[model samples]
Target: MADPLALTPKSSYAELPLRIVSAILIAPPAVAAIWLGTPYIEMVVLAAVFMMAVEWARLVGHDRNPWLIGAMTAGAPQPVIGYFFGGFDIAAILTAILFLAMLVMAKIAKLPRGLWLAAGIPVIVLPAISLLFIRNDPMGVQTALWLVAVIAATDIGAYFSGRTIGGPKLAPRISPKKTWAGLIGGMLSAALVGTATILLIGEGDIPLIAVVSAIMAVVAQMGDLSESAVKRHFGVKDSGAIIPGHGGLFDRLDGFITSLPTIALATALSGASVLQWH
Candidate 1:
């Protein structure tokens, strides 16, 4: 999420060095895990979930309460999800339980923004659950890879387009850096990459997948914007300082929080992998 693409009107050459170094260090391992699938993917999901929970609690609660940490830890549902990662039903049930547990923990911690503190449980956790569930699906590898590609393309497209075009802001108040040109660039990029992914995999409804990819690109941007709104509301600059140039795990994955859950739910209701969406 934190990239040189949107730091200023044009691509920030000054920040390019750090961004490149960070991407080199982080992206390879992540791409490999998604490519590998199974236990490796689960490890990625769990690590991200835990980090996001901690960051989210701190951002909203603005406190260092040990109880909040405990709630964030419990809200992650590690062993429960770790052992049952293969089962979507187990994840769903665990999600509900964890949601309630976080709410209660929020009350117990007596954080000033208790309700916002509780909201992070689901927001930070659902994508992790979705990734786990989707990775265990019949077309797990292909589906997972396509989702990644589409999202990556969206980010790349938005970054380059927004900087290059330097158009009017998409939502001046929510995220002044974002532009309409960037959104369209992201949608177009998602459509092409998503359809190309289906072509490469030799499966799925290409036209529909293209359309969905474009829509999900919008969803991803919306997710990013929502996160911006949240940050603005809280008067925070970055979510946390975990990743070198990426601010935090939450900052890195703010978009996925929305897009992953949307696709997972759609894929689930369709009773098929995205490859079989037709």
Candidate 2:
């Protein structure tokens, strides 16, 4: 059996330049995510989430029900969307209701029967909901930028770190490509990004932001691993070959799903500078 982490062109070096190019392409939207304000950012993010849900459903062997994916992505992001159109309470309640209703539907749906449906609901909601906390914060836009920076750092750091170090596997069962060295490399990368942002970026709570970024890095990797587990269970590789180098939107956003919720919760609980309370 060939090593999964043998630095293949298709999976490794080939992706380096593409990833750099992708970063260059992505920077504008990411900047806009903050400069453009919460509503527009939320809208784009929700749209991406909707698309990912549809792709994820197909990848998970649920070819019979495309509408379920539609319902999930549409309904899940409704709460976040509601915040822009209505208010936070309304948006949260609507999404919660939709989730509850979906829970019942998932239980009742006798076809294929699995926990993923239930899991998917929260996975969709958490990141969207996290945005609310982010939007409400005084440093919301900066916070959003920092959050994105942390995840990006992890991705970039892990790639180089893993490639350079190349040691033991992290979780070979779920993600054969991941290595322990890579995990550490990713975390350290996030830490460096966090520290740099804190020292250089003229925004956010330095210590708090660094801590949050570090935590998010781990969570992001966990999210990636979780998504990998889901894909493995379904015997699929890449949610979809949508991006030239990247797999799919779901594959791209997997880390964000985990990191966003953690950032939201931390911001809410810590009374961090990220949030402005009256």
Put down candidate 2 lDDT per residue, 1-278, tens digits, no spaces: 01122232234555676666656765677568667875677767677667766775677666468668766666766766776778767766876687677768777876463456656666776686676567578777767877787888888777876777677778889887777777777777777787787676565555665665667778898888888888888897778655574677677778878877787777778776442221
Cα lDDT tens digits, model 1, 165-206, are 767778888887778888888889999997898788887889
Quick one: best TM-score, which candidate?
A: 1
lDDT of model 1 at position 245: 43
* Regions of candidate 1 where Cα sits further than 4 Å from its true position: 3-13, 78-86
RMSD of each: 2.5, 4.0
- The lDDT per prediction is 0.74, 0.69
Kindly report which residue stretches of model 2 are placed more than 4 angstroms away from their true locations once superposed: 1-12, 24-27, 85-88, 107-109, 202-212, 274-278
TM-score of each: 0.89, 0.84
Alpha-carbon RMSD, candidate 1: 2.5
Candidate 2 at 194: error in angstroms?
1.4
Number of residue pairs clashing in candidate 1, backbone atoms closer than 3 angstroms, sequence gap of 3 or more or interchain: 0
